[model samples]
Target: MEMSELTALLTPEGLRLLDALGTVETTDAAARAVSTLRAAGHGPDLVAAVVGQAHLRAKARTKFGEFASRMLFTRAGLEQATRLSVAARHAGRLRTAGITHVADLGCGIGGDSLAFAGAGLRVTAVDADEITAALTAFNLAPFGDDATVLHSTAETADLTGIDAVWLDPARRTAGHSETRRVAATDYSPSLDWAFDLATRMPVGIKLGPGHDRDQLPAESEAQWVSVDGSVVELVLWSGALARPGVHRAAMVVRGGHTHELTAPADSEDAPVRELGAFLHEPDGAVIRARLIGDVARHLEAGMLDEHIAYLTSDAALTSPFVQSFRVREVLPVTPKAISAALRAGEIGTLEIKKRGVDIDPATFRKKLTLRGPNAATLILARVGSKRHAILADRVDAA
Candidate 1:
């Protein structure tokens, strides 16, 4: 649907119709609401506004009903909702680290702040956008009056004496669509300013997983969090907030159960193993935690390479941080040979995963004309080089 049509369906009359209908669950409800508003002779603009507003409100409520706060509707704000599990895990870590108060810098729509308050920490939430700050107040209103929302950039925001600070730098411009021209340094509350704030307060900053390692401070602990096997966000913690090291953790919440994969700080010994019947690739978090070696040791498996993170064995192994898959076949990396092998086996549909391979999955899929069979192949590469493909059946762990 056009944005204009969407806006027209979001009018006062449209909102009234929606409210009268209670909550929207079907497209028919949306269509009927639009039809009713249009029949009532409501202008297109009001209709559109009401529809848009309802959609946003419904989305916010659906995603964040557990916490109360206003919506910022920014890219970063959306990312927060998407990474809620990661935020909650980070909050748990902070609680363990003895942080009872948090100064949430750039608190767009109060995403992380909600998690902080949910963790029972006092929060002083700050944002640069006036509307966002107001929305933050509204979103945080349901927390039973313990959260304070502020409208100001971190540079000028008063953060003195707060136990911890959460910083998420704005990565977009006001106009919204000109991101190609926007720069990270252009944030009103710059990273330099955030770093300075970290020195005085326990600070946890949310950054893109692809952020430069050089940009990270030498004394900070950097964590990469993934949910359901998908890497989502990278968190940086200062000494005041956490101990120094490269920490990687998978924040898994399955069926109301929560688990994490963390490497012990003291264990540096790698795993030793002889060839086994199956190889297990540790989860990203376990790899990031630098504990795959420990996991290998725990499983009595050998590393394919000291630097490479893949573990191999002839015996069955059990670990939370890795998935065990039985090797069906191994082949040298070649387009024609791989394609012929796939075609000869009548394998039509395939999932190609590569770690060290230089070929893009999309490009390889196109080149091989893969289709017909249901199978998944893992393309392991050298530590820094790409390895050939390993066609395998995923071992059901549970």
Candidate 2:
């Protein structure tokens, strides 16, 4: 959004209109709301800003929950904003480390800064973009003097007395939408500068989960986090912010429950064994953290393949780190043979899961001629270079 539009949005009349408009869910509804506001003599700029914000607030519910309603967001800021729950965890870590003051460099929309303030830490939230900084200031207003928003680059921000630093470097293009990923070396403030700052003070850096592991600093504690089955981001903690004796961690947040596995170093891969009665799929966080072997050891399981993350065990074992499935039967990897097996098993609906293969699940689903009275999950994987289709039933955690 333009600075003029933002200035107008902060005005008394604009605030009143935005408060009255509530949330506009659908595009049709937003269009109608915009038309009504225009008919009421509002200018196109004001109408457009309020209507766009209404839709953004609605979408922000997934990340910020109720707090989103009172906040303004830039399209790019909201997309990159950390989920409140996840931010809360970051805040807890800082609090636990005895950090009283934090400098949130490149604080997008003040999401993490808000968490830091709420955790009772004095926060200096800085964003280089004028509009984003203004929006952050608005979002953090409720905290009064506890939080301060600044419009400046991370490299230029003053960090003299800040107890710790939280850096979220701009990893994508400048646009609000249609943004493409930028290389790590090209990150705003640069990874080099960020890492240097980390050594001088306790620091936490948030990066994409798929970031090249080889480029990561070995001295930092790296944690991979997954929320509701989707791997989100990798966080690097340095100095006092890094947990004691924990160099690598996988945090899984599912159904409001949080679980973590930590190790000092990468765990060895479990031995590959024949298919057992049960198949286990490690959480994405665990897989990304390279701690799948640790999870396999906990479940008394072995890897299905040396390279694949799938695990199997003879006994019915349960763990928060892995989803257990009861293997019913093994079918031939060929589509025709798999279709015949499913038909004979009376499986009408199928959930196809594949790893270490190139087949698209959607296309493969279309090829299957399923007709029956049951539902089953089909796991297509390679065992010692040989492909096999395993039918299994999901075992829900009790």
Counting clashing residue pairs in each candidate, in order, gives 36, 0
Task: Give me the candidate number with maximum lDDT.
Answer: 2
lDDT of 1 at 67: 37
User: What is the alpha-carbon lDDT for the whole of candidate 2?
Assistant: 0.91
Instruction: Indicate the residue-level lDDT of 197 in model 1.
Output: 66
* Model 2 segments more than 4 A misplaced: none
**How does residue 331 of candidate 2 score in lDDT?**
85
TM-score of 2: 0.97
Give stretches of model 1 more than 4 Å off: 1-39, 43-45, 57-76, 80-82, 175-188, 243-257, 263-276, 288-291, 305-309, 334-349, 360-387
> Tens digit of lDDT per residue, candidate 2, span 91-170?
99999999999999999899999999999999999999888998999999999998999999999998989999999999
TM-score against native, each model: 0.76, 0.97
Q: What CA RMSD would you report for each candidate?
A: 5.1, 1.4
Q: Specify the poorest-scoring 10-residue window by lDDT in model 2.
A: 173-182
State the C-alpha lDDT per candidate.
Answer: 0.65, 0.91
